[model samples]
Target: MDVIVNAAASADGKLSSRRREQLAISGADDFARVDRLRAASDAVVVGVGTVLADDPHLTVKDDDLRSQRREDDRPGNPARVVVDSSGRTPTDAAILDDEATTYVCLSEAAPVDRRMALADHAELITAGEGRVDLLRAFATLQEEGLEQLMVEGGGELIFSLFEAGLVDELRLFVGPKIIGGRDAPTLADGEGFVSEFPTLELAAVDRLDDGVVLTWRVDDR
Candidate 1:
């Protein structure tokens, strides 16, 4: 599967404030770009933390884009995926709506009752023991016909994807604002790498709004 990680961050590299609330860091142009990306993907993925924080719908937004997908014999919105190891995703989360198919990736450690509850609203895929194994989860997604995946992330999930070498491309919009806080979340925020950091090859750059969009191809090591 082709995995793309897309995000918007402030000039200081923070995704949001120290409080972990959702903030608008990108402008209209970037929003439209992201909507297009969602229209093109087979599935949109996010970690549970993102769901708890933002409660995003994870669906195609533009009317024209939805029409295009329908014309292509595809669903108006792509599938939605959540990596919730312990089944912490709220039953009423926006992603669980009927707008699209939803998949919740869980670990074996998740409670059976919780899994059963979620199964009514989503398809459940269990992998790993203590945490959701991203590699295995994505492999299962591919088997289910999700060949192109777009990940709209919380930093921890982004870092996990990079650590597992699952990310193929990164599309980042650097906005013109400074949200400086030591406790604020950045682009990648799991247990950071100590050595052998992942490298990127710059593919393209474009000016957008008051910021710039950077396209990078993750170089295989």
Candidate 2:
């Protein structure tokens, strides 16, 4: 399966400040590009924190693009995948609005009630004991015939995927704004590398109307 991670960060490499917020880093052009990417993908993924913080719809929103996808015999919208290890995703989250198929990946220890509630709006899949086992989740996605997955992030999810060697490509849009804070979230945030380091080879760079988008391929070999 091909896994692509996508994000738009500030000039200072911050996704957002350490405040209650929904960061508007991407511009209209970037959003249209993202919609095209979403239309091309089999599934669009994000962490539960993204849902709790931004309440994004996580579906293809452009009418013409949606029409074009359907004309091409594709799904009107890609399936929505949410990684919620502890099952913290709200039942009313925008991703659960039935705009598309929703998969809630949870830990094995997720509470039964929470699982049941989410099941009303999503298909629940247990991937790990106390956190999401991304490899298992990928296997499940592949089994479901959703091989082209796009992971949009809220830091933790991106870090986990990168750490697990699941990310194949990364599309980072660098905006002009700089939200500098020691506590601000970044593109990849977790217990970062200490000894051995991973690298991403630059594949392409394009200047958008409001920012520059850089594409990199993870070179784990």
Candidate 3:
């Protein structure tokens, strides 16, 4: 599968505030651009933290943007995926809404009853032990026929995917504002890298009204 991580951060590389909440970092223009990407992808993924914080619908909003996919004989919206290792995702979460097919990737330790609860709204899959093994999750998604996966995330899931060598491309929007806090979230946050960091080759850059969008090809070299 071709994995692309789409995220936006402040000038200081903060994604949210100290409370582990979500903030509107980008404006309408960048959001529309992101919607187009979502509409084009076969699957859109996010971490459970994002669901807890924002409870986003995870559907393409623009009728015009959605119609483009339908014209191509694709689903009006992409399959929505959530990485909830502990089966913590709520059944009533917005992702469970009827707009799209939802998949919840849970850890092997998830309780059977919890799985049964979400089964009505989402197809559940087990990937790892205590936490989701992203590589295994990707393979399961591939086996299920999702070729292009777009990850819109909180930090931990993004870091796990990159650490597992799954990311192929990155789309980053950097806004001008500065949200300064040591506890603030970032683009990637997990076990901090112990060795050299992975490099990304710049593919493109666009200057939007409120921010700049940067595209990078993950340099596996």
Candidate 4:
């Protein structure tokens, strides 16, 4: 599967404040760009942290875009996927709405009751023991015909994807604002790399809104 990781951060590289609340880092043009990216993907994935923090619908926003997907014999919106290991995703989350198919990835350790509850709202995929195995989950997604995946993430998930060597492209939008806080989330924030970092080939750069967009292709080392 083609995996694209996309995010917007402040000039200082913070995704949001230390409070972990949702903040608008990109402008209208960037928003439209993201909507287009979503429309082109087969599934849009995010971690449970992002769903709890942002509650994003993860749908193609443009009416014409939805129409185009339908005309192309695709769903009006791509499937919404949540990498929730312990089934922490709220049943009432926006992604659980009937707008599109929802996939909740869970680990074997997830509570039976929680799994049962989520099964009513989403298709459950078990791929690991303690934590959701992203690689295995994604393989299952690919088997289900989701060939192109877009990941809009919290830092931990982004870090895991890179650590698993699953990311293919990185599109980052650096906005003009500066949100300075040591605890603030950045583009990739898990146990950061200490040795061989993932190499990226600079592909393109373009000015969008008041900031700039940098596209990088992950180099196979």
Q: Once superposed on the true structure, which residue ranges of model 4 sit more than 4 Å away at CA?
A: none
**Cα lDDT, all candidates:** 0.96, 0.91, 0.91, 0.96
**Candidate 3 pairs with clashing backbones:** none
lDDT of 1 at 217: 97
lDDT of 2 by residue, 182-218 (tens): 8888998988878657798999999996889999999
Where in model 3 is the C-alpha error above 4 Å? none
Q: Give per-residue lDDT, candidate 4, residue 80.
A: 93
Spell out the clash pairs found in candidate 2.
none
Q: Model 2 scores what on Cα lDDT?
A: 0.91
Q: Lowest summed-lDDT stretch of 10 residues in model 4?
A: 212-221
Q: What's the TM for model 1?
A: 0.99
Q: Report the C-alpha displacement of residue 114, candidate 4, in angstroms.
A: 0.5
Q: What is the C-alpha RMSD of each candidate to the true structure, in Å?
A: 0.7, 1.0, 1.1, 0.7
Clashes of each: 0, 0, 0, 0
Off by over 4 Å in 2: none
lDDT (tens digit, per residue) of candidate 4 on 99-150 = 9999999999999999999999999999999999998999999999999999
Q: Name the lDDT value of residue 135 in candidate 2.
A: 93
TM-score for all predictions?
A: 0.99, 0.97, 0.97, 0.99
